[model samples]
Target: MALTVDKLMNDERFSGDNVLQFLLYLPFGILLLVVRLLLALVLWVASIILPNKSGVRQMLSTLACWTFGVYVKLKGTRDPRCSVMVANYVSCLDSLAASHVLGTISLRKWKVPPFFASTLGIRNAAQFVRKQHFAECPSKPVLLQPEGGPTNGKGLLKFTDWPCPLGNRVQPVAISVERMFTNVTVHGGDSRSSFPWADALWFLCTPVTVYSLRLLPPVERHDDDDAAMANNLSAAIAEALQIERTEFKWEELRPRGRAPPSRRAGGAGDVTTLARQVKEVLPAVPIHDILRDLAKTRSVDVTITNFLEGVTPYTPEDTTEPRPSTSKPRYVTPAPTGVFPKSAKERQLSFQERKAQMIAEAKKRYIEKNGLNLALNNC
Candidate 1:
């Protein structure tokens, strides 16, 4: 269906008596514009009187989310060390969702300079701009939609050439719309039918909507060079946004293909090895003891045998046939007993490796089971 703006400007839907309808809408349009402006003024006053930090912004965002009937679901932990968040541009709802759930700062690229300048929410949003860093102001996590505008639920060209500094590690987020609509006069307007205004209202008035924040693991900042950091940050954001890394197709918006293997090959492998080594080192721990410890302080159910089975060195040829039974009577080995890993780094490294390996294996299985035929046919 054509949008209201398009119907008014291009299609002659607004011709004849429609002109009268347009005239009727003029007053409501003016009223909305005024209310928006007042709200913006209030936000400006609040920013001046209250703290100019993420907490205030988040509280305001939560209120806005409630006002719009939006609920935010945060999946993973936000890296406490990092101060930046990057996400896919789905709708204007992303701003409210991100602010409320992540408690991080958000930013948007507007077609017009004064787009939301009159709304208190927008006024508060302006504080996240990258240029306002000199006022002893902490830079809020900026949310960019790169797409710049909405499309027909189709993700389009949204990334730009502007260099984003890596002064803060960025947490990539994905925003998905559970339900949405456009141009049915939930409120009234003739020219207010474009995506910008229509979407803003949908985000403002919807009764119930859900937003999910899938936080990818954070990347370390290794360099001080802005250019290099920006490039790295862009790459990280692209990965977080699930942009196709191998092919440069902007039209295909859905995440396609498996994540490329890490450039630091031995690094990820080291994690797997460490996990296996820890299991081997503590082989004397009884399965019950290990399981009890995991149940109390962790969620892992993996036993020493299972852990060893996963990371034990094996060759492709080893999978050619099953092992032959020995002549001796079969015997079940007793569980090992030993002290657990003590170093925090060692424990963390082992856990991360196991998680990464599981993710990789899952992806591999999915690709193998589905294959290229399914992807092309489904698409």
Candidate 2:
């Protein structure tokens, strides 16, 4: 879809780019985070004590959202007649805010406890039924996200048709999330790597996250074509949100050539450790440059290879002490005395030649040690 990594994910939103600024805010942010979390928890408990449909319960929920630094503003009126609402996916809080205003039950299937279901507007689906069951029973208004997953609010992902057939008239809601104090991403784009819990934690860390939802008029379905209906509704929501529609799906939002979070080793949790590993292989490469590539590739070997192959361009930083080449013995062998490489291409060629020479020498030593030379002469 020609979508860049930045469009799908905010890789540098909370980045420790400016060491001084991060250091200055770390202590204050943590303190505010703990205080806000406690207040939100108390409010949530109070809301649970009240009746579900009670106006007091909704007010308590609103207070809880405020405590959690989530501010929601609703623009258009929700159609009471339509029981199905479709919105573009952005964050976990989308369901929370929608539930707060529209009182809709989220059908996005979050694997959390029932206790958390009230707060998140999510339900855990058992093996037998989930959204399908909700679609059948039209008791409460059901909220479904046709994008299937979150994206950085730049554009709209192609919608899925599963939510289209839930109701004859689907309500299209355009949701936009913005932050205050710090310019953080509304949602972490990669679903495979980022979870709802992580997003919630970041929410507490940030000062405030504002959600603006515009409820469009109900989209009436004439033909029984779910795909066509979904597409038309998607275009409508995109126009309302003033964002372009992309052919990109949620699955395609993952970083290109990157491994899933579980498979990502050193760089997954501790990127600095992975950068150090890359630094060991390419001593001339800067730590920041190594970290940048590791953030994208999330692998020490891949970052090192990127530096060695010149796939990632960087100017060599001056080193106080010269270090020996640290490339693996199998892939790269050391050159003879006084030999040096002036360029990446020459260095690679030299390594390959040295590796070949080493292999040939190993073969000769094996033949000589095993008396194969004498045997060949006899033959």
Candidate 3:
């Protein structure tokens, strides 16, 4: 396990394709996108005369896999026959992965012009509401990331206030993503957090991504209480990813123990010796495969088990296999707006609370504007 996670992430070689992987698959991704567009147009025109439905959706699903050259393996039991699909969020690519097996993605909440919405099937595929409420199983199977945004794939974040709002009985789907050899996984905790395209680029540019689609046994309203069922489903996903469990919110899980600063201040350090020591404990599997499972599900509880405080310093030792990295775009993901969040409890705000927060922000802006106006008048 000399292959520390940080090294693979920073080495710059494993950033998806070498000259070959990109030249080979980037064209495919682009070509398939063109094909997808052309086919969608043809299907739209044909829908006018054709009595049967156009198969554009099925085509989109298939093209997603071909475009990336990255393989997808969807396992476990699933029957959209049950209605709604609840999934664990990892990357935005989860939708593409689902499209391979399911139909058109839920257009989400994008407000497209009427012309585009009709042609692209956005009108029929989208869903928007103040709150997700109880409903019958959707006939066409609606996919929802109840967690709202993506996570590191190590543990489950706090679920939005479902409380059985969107039907008490639901099928939980775990969409686990493995980003070959990188430590960072796809995530979108909030708008200020990370963008989907940026994460997708990092994933696509990486060597390969293994997606595990685990469809859990359906949890019915009558079978268990809402909280219990959610816990069970979350635990099932955690077991699949081989990570620990956490029911707490994102910011609540940082501290280790009630120890002095001298005792715990060294968490962030250049612990090469510690890296070597902890490397010994990593599972005796290929780092690539280990990363796949880790991306699928590595719990936050164990996120600190190996490294001290800061990331373990990494340096590559020459290997037998020839390297495959040169002139790739140096991926630069920006930091969040502020170095730290304004509040610990605000990360998981509810719909109403979020609206209130937005209103307060607007009022603050107006007050500042008026204050500046009065100051100018006085001057």
Candidate 4:
């Protein structure tokens, strides 16, 4: 079976890529098993000696340096060591790719297979945390996949009811998955799988699985402000990954009985959530450009100083007395003496020129989008 657009679009598990993967991996399964054992043994020993997250993280990061022919491109400053990495859940390969850049400690679900149990699992490097006690303390940097589970890596899931359990000093990370051999980007699909074991094997066996980690600036919390921190981090993550923020909770969006209170309150909560989530995450900070666009749309100069603080720096001018009719709302005639187009042919030329310019601008924008997607896919 040859890899085709039909298969990729449909995302069948037994696509040509998977067949190639099977052939590539089956021959080296034993070698991979041995390597996994060695890595697990080393990690197990390190974990037994180092009871804290920092020590484990240090060991894992060190190990990542020696293994895998993978491409790990990390972008951003490393700071606030005690910060939870709120990253997008792509595939099982996330930890290994992430481990290459920094030491990560996860307080996720405690389900590690028996073979690598010592190095992984609740009792190992990643502490086991139940839902009730997810983030009871801020003692260490907890690796959190706020999406609850994996997605297609192209979309984002809604942040759970409680996104920030570790309380601020939040570092938002987005890990984009791209397989070099086949252009099949892994995530949640039938032709592919999101299981950690499968992803790990792919990483180890494949020549180069590109993992682009974009670490946005950390959000510092002065007090117990979890909601603000979660919103800010999630919105930043969404924007960084080029995905939409799922603001409405699932139940709230479902068609049901009388709906919720906030729905009845004219979605005030949703407005507040979006406003609080808005803080510049774009490269070079295009807040000025955004404000300019907004001003043009509203026909009013925008003065939004602090987006995160939900502060509207400019208010619309009051029209309390209705402004006494202004200038009678009449169109003035075109200046006949100026260098304006006089003939129909000249006017047609001007219109065509403007039309061409508009088409050129549209093409430029479309090209930019395609380029970004290519970059995201690590092409």
Best by TM-score: 2
lDDT for each of the candidates? Answer: 0.45, 0.70, 0.47, 0.50
lDDT of 2: 0.70
lDDT per residue for candidate 3 within 298-376, as digits (tens), equals 3221212212221222333344577777775323233345544456656545445656656655655666877754332
Clash pairs for candidate 4: 12-191, 13-191
Q: Give the worst 10-residue stretch by lDDT in candidate 4.
A: 296-305
lDDT of 2 by residue, 51-82 (tens): 66547656766776766688889999888778
Return the clash pairs for model 3, or none. Answer: 16-205, 16-206, 16-207, 133-165, 154-298, 154-299, 267-309, 267-310, 268-309, 268-310
Error of 1 at 290 (Å): 62
lDDT of 1 by residue, 75-166 (tens): 87777656656565555556667766654544323333332331223322323234343234444454544333332232233343222342
Models sorted by lDDT, best on top? 2, 4, 3, 1
Off by over 4 Å in 3: 1-54, 104-139, 181-189, 192-195, 223-225, 250-379
The candidate, 2 or 3, that scores higher on TM-score is: 2
For residues 132-162, write the lDDT of model 4, one tens digit per residue. 2335544435566655455555456566524
lDDT of 1 at 148: 35
| Model 4 residue 54 CA deviation in Å | 6.9
Cα deviation in Å at residue 9, candidate 2?
2.0
Model 3 lDDT, residue 243, Cα: 60
User: Pairing residues by index, what is the TM-score of model 3?
Assistant: 0.46
Return the TM-score for candidate 1, rounded to 2 decimals.
0.40
